[model samples]
Structure formats: structure tokens, C-alpha cells
Target: MTRSWIGRRAVVAATFLLALSPLAPAAAAPPVVEAAGAALRPAGAEVVAVTKVAERLTDLSVRSPALGGRVVKVRLLTPDGWNPADRRQHWPSFWLLAGCCGDYTAWSGTDIAKIESLRKVLVVMPEAGWNGWYSNWWNHGAGGDPAWETFHTVELRRLLEKDWGASSNRVVAGLSMGGQGALLYAARHPGMFRAAAAYSASAHPLLNTESINRIMGFFGGQGGDPRRVWGDPVAQRNIWAAHDPYYLAHHLKSLPLYLSSGDGTAGPFDQPDALEADFNRQNKALAAALTQAGAKRLTTNFYGPGTHAWPYWQRELHSSLPILLTALNVRP
Candidate 1:
């Protein structure tokens, strides 16, 4: 009986030892973690997770130091034969930024993922925050945290180029607030984009008081302090001008540009009672500024009877693709 008890104890001990053996098969890492660690992280950022949402759509949750160590989502509409694990492959990138209240998924929420003309390029749609304005928040002159500009242009750009298959050749397009971002990024960083397009953009917000008030209203959205973004417009006039695309027109003269907008009237895509959009005059002013600044490769579609809506922006996207793709040296 004692020997029987000893044998039972020995059996249990052997089973426990076998379970701890180094030769035992280890548990596999989560697919998301494996994918996140597949590539080298950018200097101040790391991809925390990756989700394959669909056939060609991937959502990367990145932890950004520029954004105060916040984790944000960035959607990738990958091209055919593109592989994140393969470092040798690089495709031209199309940055489709979202508007003030929208997230990174805004463009994919449209039919852009199905557009065949965009199949050959890597479409990077990053979260610019709700009312992020695509600018580093002034934060009362402290100048840190929630730095959208550095997050996008520096950390995210480097990550995509190093890990994901994004080439140096790039084009940018957006609507509304994002349209402003598209233009600002191109102008602020010379040679960053091959071409730029904006639809129904608040192009010249510094043109007058009405425009200034309108944007200040946007700045005050979602319980945010208007002063946190760029400070008092009166006090921070230089900062405001620095971010205004109209004021930066001279910097954009060399790149291919596509500017299109509606007169804010009811058009084919709008209801009969659609109110006029206030951005028409802004677009017109920006177009003139670009031309006057010696922009030779500019295209303006200011289609007369439209409104600032998705239908018009979608159409404008299709219309501008030829120029965008041409600038990227990709066939439409």
C-alpha cells in the first residue's frame, strides 16, 4: 500500500516535469502581436495591434508619443500583391485624410475601397482626432501632446515606409477640414506630396472675419477650448497664417494641384432646399491665389451648381484621380 502511494506520487511528479520541459510545444503568440512585431517600429511610435478587417483593409492601432502616448487607429487600403512582411516591396501611397468630426475610417466608409483606379496604390487613412485640425495643438504655448502634425508626418509616415509597403511617391486628397489638412501638409512640407486635391475645402479661412468665426466655431466643438488649438486668433495671428493654405500658396506652386468645389447651391446630388455652403468663396480665393503664385499644373473644376456634400466630393475624387495618378506615375 505504501509502494502504491509512492508510485502515484511519482507519476504526478513526472507529469508535472513533462509539462515544464523545454521541448514542450509553447503557446503561440496572438496573430495581432506577431503582425505588430513583424516590422521595425518608428522612433517615437509603435504599432500595438493590427486587425485584418477585410480583404485589403487593415487597421493598425499605433501608440504615438507625439499624441501624448495615445493609441490611435490608422486604416490601410492595401494594393494587390502588397505584403507588410516583405520589406523589399514599396508602392506609391495615397493619403486620404478625414474631416473634423470623422475618424480614420471615414474614407473606407465610402466606396473608395472598391474603386479600381486606386488598386495599385497604398491608401493611408490616419486618425487626425475629432477636431484635431491636423495641427500640433498650441496648448497655450507649451507645444506638446496631441501633436497631430508630428504624429502623421513624422511617426506614422516613417512606420508605414519602414514596415508597410509605402513608397516615397505620394498624393493627398480630402474634403472639408481634411481638405484643409491635405493642402496644409503639401504646402508646409515641400516635396512631400506628388500632387494635392481638395474638395469643398475651407481654403482661405483667414480671408475675413466670417471665415475666422466659422473656423473658431469648429475649434470650439466637442467641449474643447478654442484657445488650445492655435490660441486666440488675434494674439496668434502669425500661427494662424502659418497654417492657412491660402497664405502658403507660394509653397504649392510647383506641385500638381486639383481644386474643385460647388457654389453651395442645390445641385444634382442635393435636395431642392439645400442651403448654400460658405466654402465656395474660399475655394475661389484659393484657386486665384494658386494661379497667381505661378502654379502651372493646377486644375480647377468649381462645378457651379453643387453643394458641400459627399456625392460632390466622391465625383471630385473620380475627376481628380487622373491628375493624382498621373503625378504618382501610375496609370489610371
Candidate 2:
């Protein structure tokens, strides 16, 4: 019995190391660590329902405490032959965030399903709210419900990590607003992700006056007080600073970062008259800031011809596979 116990500890120790090793594939289920208050919620939070949407697609409705105990939809795209029922199987996780006005189905409609590297990862797509900004509302500095930050980073994270076959080795990617979210989450929660990729991200919303006002307008248009999102830009400078990627670039220094965007010019995928240069402008500033901040690892693609559309984002998403897969350690 003592010999058997020693062997079990050795295997468990090796599995823990594999979670951090880039070249090693993930083990089955992660070794159960001592759970604290909220981290234990994953084991307790009820998986209200699970529906298999496709051979590889499964959608679930989870009652999340971070979302004020409201039931939200989370979609999962499993790799080939992935089985969630097998307690002895686990896979690395890839979180695909959606942009404004998008939901769990955003990335589903794209050609991402065809990627070969996907076979090694479990993709997580969560509802970030209609215009959640991936943040807990500032509520005029009072702070309140719709805690998107807590929901995604804490609540949902625990849910997937504990219940689903998601391992600690993870990477996040998104487009447009979700592009901002990918950076925000990575910067705000240092070491939570191995790397982050943003396609047409708004990396530096507070970099300039025009950008500031533009973000404010976006916040206001979505039917919420602008101050409620991050408080007044002046009085609550710290709050805004906390949310802006440019200001928080230091946290991303150690992680593999990928930033991509176009100059809003019409491309094969967009109409001739449409221009989404604002994102291009922000993406450039972010790239510059990350550089100035001495971020040791970074990758950028400022491809200057596309607009804010799925085609451009889709292409970038595919192009970013090398970086994304490398971060997840699914590739060399």
C-alpha cells in the first residue's frame, strides 16, 4: 500500500508539470487541488443543462453567481472524438471571445471549425453581454451587477476548469470588441493565460481624445450611462486606466501577445464605402505601447486593407493559428 501511494504521488507530480510544459500534451483530469471559497464554486455550480448542437458543438446553460445567478449560455466546440464524460481525459482550453452585439455563436459561424490544430484544444465561447465591455459596470463608481470580468475570469473559469476538460494551459483570442476583451482579460489577470491574440482590437481606447470620446459614445449608445461603465473619465481616471490596455501593457510583458488590425480600407470582404479605421488607429497605438513597455514577447499584423467584418477577422484568426497554437503548446 505504501508503494502504491508513492507511485500515485509520482504520477500526480508529473501531471502537474505537464500542465506547464509546452511540448507535453495535457493529462486527463487535473489533480484536484484544495479549493477555497469561490474557486470551489465550480464544483458546486449546477450545470443546468447541456445540449449537443453538433458532432463537436455543445451548448450549456449555467446559472452563474457572477452574472447575478442568472442563467447564461456557454458554447463549447470540442475537438475530434472529444469526450466530456471520460473523467480521465482533459484538454487544453482555448477561449474565443465575441465582439459587441455578439454572443456564444459568434465564432461558430466562421470557418474556424476546419482548423486542424483545433483537434488538440477545447474551445470555450461565453456570452459577454450585449455591450458588456468584458467589465463589471462601474455604476458611477459605486459598482454593481453584470460582472462580466468576474463572470469570465473567475466564475466561468472555475466552471470550465472544474467541470469541463479544460486545463490550466490556455490562450484567449477575439475580434473587434472581443479583441479588446482578450487583451483586457490577459492584462488584468496576469498569468491567467499563456498568451492572448486580438484581431482588429481596440487596444488603446484612452490613448487620445477622439478615441476617448468615441468609446464614451459607444458606451452611451448601448443604453447605459457612460460613467457607469468605468466612471467619469476624469474623476475616475484610475478606473479607466485599469480598463485600458495601453495603460496596462506592463502586465502583458511576459506573455506571448498577438495584435492584428487593418486600416479600415475596403478589402475583398467589405463594401467600398465602409471605413473602420478607428480600430486600426487603436491597434497601432497598442502595438507601440507594448513595445515601449518592453514587452519581451509580441506579434503584430497591421494588415492595412480590411474593414471590421468577419472575413477580415476570419482570415486573421486563421493566420494567427501558429501563434495561438504555440501559446497553447499544441504546436512547436
lDDT of 2: 0.72
Tens-digit lDDT track for model 2 on 149-212?
A: 7778877777787778787788999976788899888877766788899987768776655456
- Candidate 2 local lDDT, residue 233: 64
What does candidate 1 score on TM? 0.84
lDDT of 1 by residue, 2-45 (tens): 22111231112222222121100012111111111123233579
The global C-alpha lDDT for each of the candidates, from Candidate 1 onward, is 0.76, 0.72
RMSD of each: 20.7, 16.0
lDDT of candidate 1 at residue 163, scale 0 to 100: 95
Winner by lDDT: 1
